[model samples]
Target: MDPPPPPQPPQFSLIPPSQIPPPQQNSNPNIQPDSIPNWDQNPNLTHYLDLSVPKKRRRGRSQRNSALFRSPLTLNASSNNDLSSYAITSSSSSAAVAPPVSFSSIRNPPPSLTQSSSAYDFSDEIIMINKEPKTEAMIALSAGFPADSLSEEEIETGVIPVIGGIEQDKTPTEPSKPGVIIIGAGLAGLAAARQLMRFGFKVTVLEGRKRAGGRVYTKKMEVGSRVGAVAELGGSVLTGTLGNPLGIVARQLGDVLHKVRDKCPLYSVDGKPVNPDMDMKVESAFNRLLDKASRLRQLMGEVSVDVSLGAALETFRQVYKDAVNDEEMKLFNWHLANLEYANAGLISHLSLAFWDQDDPYDMGGDHCFLPGGNGKLVQALAENVPIFYEKTVHTIRYGSDGVQVIAGSQVFEGDMALCTVPLGVLKKGSIKFIPELPQRKLDGIRRLGFGLLNKLCHSCWWSPVDCFSGR
Candidate 1:
């Protein structure tokens, strides 16, 4: 038997050298014979020696055992059955080398590795490695199995491993756009919803009332021969035309505006018209007093005790009371009532210093009335908006994840919530907040007052002459 080939020199490698073919010869004339040996053809030998070759291994569980003897730190299996196939040398030695193993492929291991019948399952072993603190040996073993290979349950529980002092995170694909919940489908809320929708956000508006226009109600009534006359119940006039948002919307809607004439006839409670000359004198005096109050406020700056506008006007009125009769005094009182009406607050409650703070930003130009009433503007804004009427949102719970609004029997959830409810509603504590509103906001809501005005529309057939003749 030729002395059994000298006992094969005690082959230390698991793979026999007889099975590994010789390095193929280069066909190109320019290639030197001394060039680096192509170890890809001899994977068994390369794996045994733990050689760092440029070429990658084939993709499959069959090739997993090819690197079984790569390092002592690497997990091992008792069975060598799977290793026998790779041990058999490649028949086509001149085949092109495979590409290098991608990081993604390493992260997402082959499915067959989990279904292996070996004594040791690499999937379980990888979980065990992740549980233990990262060490040099564990990292060396973890190189073959990445953290992403773990199941979703393990990943959610944070069983990922840290390699080279850097913890690897499974970066999932980005989620879809966020959705917003809007409370109170008022002008502010509707406007915000439209803006957010334009920016690719999903919006839902919840209105407590059956109709969208909060506090803006318009009704049709018969006036003399006219069948349908527009009667404004709230916010009748658009205060200004220039730089007014409502004016802009009106223009966009192609609606005509009737400019209110600057002619207002003053009458006493008894129906007798006041003398124009006396009205002008009282009005001029009232305006002078307001200008004087403004100058006094500028000189005083801030005061410890807040003074009401009524108190200042009353002091000036006392000086003028001696120069006027009861009728002129009534005109003066009427002017004060007008101021209260304009501010929607009593003169006694109006702050003397900060009451006119918003005056500088007041829109300029003629105050006009929309033909169909302000309700048309509300209808335009409500157009195409996803509004849930009569939602009656009562509770708002907000957190890091998102917001939850409890409206009547329904609970609405969204990525964020916008609260545009009226100040009166907030002050009344009609809606309950989960953690309660901030103290600062609560204080402001308490300090700020709200008022309402009732409009009574009367249709009269009598002319101006008939009214003066008591008809």
Candidate 2:
């Protein structure tokens, strides 16, 4: 028989890059509701305990060329933002001569014990979930958190969740702190939960969205003549696989990686591609400029312990002031914009160290998209994990033993808590914390900035290109 078909891609409604799903048509044909005869329906705590056998490491597999590129961007030549940090291209301007403006920028489950079988045990819980009462009682019973308020001073300070009464039952042997509360069901929070779960600790995740899977987004698109393909609108590319734990998880979950190309799209100011033959001189000059950038990078590295990318770049500009022609300078500057945007943030706020940390060369990784869009990875991760959706945290108070969280009048206590809130939410002070946070964490919070990225896809059923990256 011919090979079977894969499941239909999800009907992603709005793939939000804002740090955080849709219609359902049964894609499978011969599938019956009772196809899996022995699936479990109740909440089975035991299933979560099942662990897979660790894969043995090969002798010299070169660690699959980790996405981390210690090599410099000047060397990679592949101009696609995929290989750069933060996918920060374009907002960087392929237009070097153009003035700086603003710009924004998974799981698995096991078989054996199924959800149906657990239904008997969790029947009441299911009813409770659907009922949506003031979650205070559930949080009280599930986490032992408090319902107290916090001071404005505490709100201003960024602090990690403190340990208190919620930790009373917590043990060092456990993977997670018993009383820990994890808010937000996206990749960061989920990853924290997975790590904690490995230590055998129970976790509570409060998701503001009605669904799990935070920023990794996918949506239906009129991608050329193709009716549907999972196009990632947020958190689209994977970087630094060699060291990025997330990248590793992505591949294990079967995400697809698209190679980034160096041949940049030349535009005629109106954004249409310029004829290659006509643009050959400029393209070749762009290539020569790459050579100059490599030398500049080396010079900057030798200059000082503390220097910003812009400063170093300025120095480089001065060095080449009288060296290259004005036309060449325009092309050279444009390519630098491409390099800086790889991190996707304001140029003024960026630094050489940030680029070094993002390190796209040695740390430079091959770029690719998730096969079914990043949404697939998110769903796989959350398939069977416990997530309470549409639950926004309101107040937090810490006691001698544990931390308490208040969400819609419901209280939960946990030994430790992980709040993977977006920078925007935290800045707005939407959720309050008591006992005050330390100054250090708060500083990090204030200093760190979140970037915005947008993609507006259409039913371009008749486009010349196969896929669009908005280059």
lDDT of 1 by residue, 143-221 (tens): 3323323323222222122322454333223323588999987778876766566446778999999988777666655
TM accuracy, model 1: 0.58
Best of the candidates, lDDT: 1
lDDT of 2 by residue, 1-471 (tens): 988984332121221222110112222222223231111321232222111111111111112222111111111122332111111112111211212211111011123323323211222331232233332222111211111222222211111122122221222354433646898888888766654554466877898888677776666575455645445666766643433444544544434455545355666456777566545654454444333333333332323224444454444444445226554444544554554445465444455334433221222234444555666667656654578888889787877788888889788888767889888887777888786667887787777765566676654445343344442
Q: How many backbone clashes does candidate 2 have?
A: 71
Q: Ten residues in a row with the worst lDDT in model 1? A: 54-63
> Which residue pairs in candidate 1 collide?
none
lDDT of 1 at 327: 77
Q: Per-candidate TM vs. native?
A: 0.58, 0.54
Candidate with maximal TM-score: 1
Residue 254 of candidate 1: its Cα lDDT? 59
